[model samples]
Target: MSDLVIGLGGLAMMFALMVFRMPVGMAMLAAGYFGTVLISGARSANALLVTETFSAASNYSLTVIPLFILMGNIASVAGFSSRLYEAAFAWVGFLRGGLASASIIGCAAFAAVSGSSVATAVTIGKVALPEMKRFRYSDALATGAIAAGGTLGFLIPPSTGFVLYAILTEESIGQLFMAGILPGLLLTALFMAAVALVTLKDPEAGPRGEWVSISMRMRALMRALPLVTVIIVSIGGIYLGVFTPVEAAGIGAGLVILMAIGMRKLDWRMLQQAVSDTVGTTAMLYLIVIGASVLNPFLALTHVPAMLGEAMTSAGLGPYGVLLLIIIAYLVLGMFMDGLAMLVVTIPIFFPIITGLGFDPIWFGVVAVIVIEMGMITPPVGLNVFVVKSVAQDVPMATIFRGVIPFWVAMAVCLLAVIVFPQIALTIPSAMFR
Candidate 1:
């Protein structure tokens, strides 16, 4: 009868639907609609639905989503991602586990344009895996680097995860993007370190790649210049306050399209495919957002977040202690849920708790994203691992999982570092925005 009971039941039913292989958006929409009707009657529920649908549809900030997705898709079709890998390989391919390290660098660079982890992994893995194999790189090191590197997609600027978080929390998308820059770079370095450590322990696992000539390196760098320019213009423009997030997306997408056309790479077929993929990805993201929009009000009416916050405070867990518990919950849930699904479902409840503890929402967004990144590589449902496995079909699933372990530890270390010094994630946003 009580709103609290209704809310609790709705959550249980939603999870049950998910267990039955229902889509996350559909499950949430169904639960929220019925729960709202139960709590506030059918008339109120109908109005709520109408207004939420309209609000989600008309949101101007959401334009950035499709544009950014288009930018990445177009870049992929243009072969810019391959150039990025070649450039990184030219520079780092001489060291032990160099090709693997180059893969991480390439993934980081591509992630600046493409915001999806699976896309980054799949795109770079296709280029890096064969090269690593040619050089006799061990399957574990090769696969591990690709999977871990893919996670940079979530932490780097233009990240879809950050975009969704910004929309949900009413945080500034530009600020969140800036907040991610430092942490993204830090994790990339940590991944490279993981590769070095792995190869150091077993030289046979990651033999040195062929030495590239200086002239060849320069040529590769030149080839990658246009993409680097696009990244600097889009992301750097945001930091300088020259371009709004939406404008940056448009410019980025436009520039990539122009480059593809200039290089004669943008055929009618490629353009059509890029647009189609963008539409599908955008629709999926919007559905998740709309579902969260519908469910959020229902949860608010039940006062569930408030109750949970009070319970957490009363349990004698200090702010940091409470945050730790929440992080642990994310790690466990991440094993079974997609990162974005986990974000949309949990942020409504956790955002309030986090802000109530006097933490900055922007900082928490970065932390949450990092934890989500960890989830993408965690076993049982490590999405990136499976992505790499799909590319390297002959590699055992267990082997890829094993390869990702050191990188996983590295991610854990990066998480702790950010927690200890929140400024690692906040300084850029604070300085630039001020």
Candidate 2:
């Protein structure tokens, strides 16, 4: 059989494993390992597996993942997430659908530290949902806001998505981080606009919250200062070229730990949990990276990416047409695949097509991350939707899905905006990196 046919069979088998509930990392590893044995020998395949696993695990840059995750975990354990939510609520809670809007803002803020959609949703949802419930906000609106907002965790700086994308594509981590900022903020605004439109249509769906006095608002902001300061210093340090991404992560994690301890919010137990959770998350991410590393070489041997690119180019679609087709494919895949899994599996195939089309890699990274995030809320396998359901058990899953529909539309709009105005994703990175 042709190597391409073998490659296709391997991919099919990989999906079959995933369908049978195998872990994504394991499925990729198995397919890549076995596929290699079929083409080369067991000897080469074994070497590939060992070298990739060790390389992925031992790579110094991977340290950023654990450190950033630790910072977020410690922040959550220390009640910093709640304080950030309270500050957001104090400032925006008085408007129509304001509480939901506050939840979005809270998610964006927490995402800066967390770099995880699930963590951002859980951290903000726990704090915001109960309060939104107390104010009698619609369950759909409340849950939807948090679910959609959580996706910012993947798009904002310190993002695991960008880190992985950089490693896969050999782009600058700082450039990708910078590329994400404007688009992330744009999505935040569009999400808030979605909340406004929802409440406008059905005013009772999201009622106005009681206004807080300026003094109280400032107090809440003060309470959130520690996290805010850490975000600024760490993320800002990257922008100013004062710290590498790994250094920023280390500083951010250390600063959060110090603040948490100083506030007496993290005791022995909480500290242990934070470290434990970070290790678990980091391990999972490392496995995915390793799996992708193994799979990429197998795919290269089959020339699948080159074949796919030739076919795409032969389709007579111009650059924009090809781009549109890829976006649609992502939306479809987002329905079934986990966002990170989709990224690791597909970037190798698509990055070459995109760059060959003369698009900016950094800009496409932002676009690609945003699209994958939409999948986190898409039905059937919406990871963020499930996370929200766990937090709001009384709310029907269908309702949460319905609630995110508007925000999903907003995301589509945001995607189109960035595509049409590539500068939205490129300007900050260009200015800073230049």
Candidate 3:
């Protein structure tokens, strides 16, 4: 059989394995190894596996993953996320739908430290949900805001999505990190606007929260100053060329650790738990990276990306047309697959097509992450929706889905804006790094 046929069969088998509840990394590894052995000899496949494993294990650039994960875990244990939520509430909680907006803002702030969407959702949801409930906020609006806001974790600087995308496409992680900043803030604004629109339609859904005095707001801000300082230092340091991405990660983690200790928040037990959590998350990420490394070579052998590129070019769909199709495909995949799994499964195939059409890889990385974020709230397997649901148990799954609808539309708008004016994603990176 032809290599293309073999490749297609391998993908089908991998999907079937995933359907049967197999881990995505293992399924990809199984398919990749089998396909490679079929196309090349078993000896070559064995050699590739050994080399890839070593490469993934020892890749210095990957240190950013663990350091950033450690920073987030420590911040969580230190109660920094709650401080962030309180600061946001002090500023915005008085307005109509302000509590929900505070949740979004708090999520964005926490996301600057923690790159995981579920972490952002769970952390902020825990702090903000009860307050919104006390204010008699509608379940849909309150839950939707948290679920949608959680997605900011994927697009903001220090994002694992961007880091993984950079590794896969061989783009500069710094540039991708820079590229995400403006777009991330833009999405945050759009999400807040969506909340406003929802509340405007039904003011009773989100009654106005109690306004705090200026002194209270100042105190809240001061309490959150450490977290804000860490974000500016780490992410801002990267843009200023003061530190590389890995260096920034190390500094960020160190700063958070110091802050936690100074606040008496870090005990031996808490420190141990944070380290353990970091190791587990890091291991899972490395496994996916290794699986992708194996699968990429197997796909290259099949020439599937080349074939698909040729087919798309021949089909007379211009660059944007082809991009639209790919975006739609991601949206569909997001409904069923985990976001990281979608990235691992699709990037090997789609990255080539994207770059082949002369699109900017960095900009495409931002776009891909936004689409993945959309999937995080998409129905069926919208991971963030389930995450928020877990925290807000009284709110039905259906209500959370309904709540995210407007925010999802807001994401669509942001996507269109970035596509039309690529500068939204590229301008900062260019000005800063060029």
lDDT of each prediction vs. the true structure? 0.94, 0.94, 0.93
Superposed model 2: Cα runs more than 4 Å off: none
How close is every model to the real structure, measured as TM-score? 0.99, 0.99, 0.99
Residue 277, candidate 2: Cα error in Å is 0.7
Task: Supply the TM-score for candidate 2.
Answer: 0.99
lDDT of 3 by residue, 110-134 (tens): 9999988888999999999999999
Per-residue lDDT of model 1, residues 62-180, tens digit only? 99999988999999988999999999999999999999999999999999999889889999999999999999998988999999999999999899999999999999999999999
| Model with the higher lDDT, candidate 1 or 3 | 1
Instruction: Supply every candidate's count of residue pairs whose N, Cα or C atoms clash at under 3 angstroms.
Output: 0, 0, 0
Mark the 10 consecutive residues where model 2 has the least summed lDDT: 55-64
Residue-by-residue lDDT tens digits, candidate 2, 401-428: 9999999999999999999999999999
- lDDT for position 39 in model 3: 95
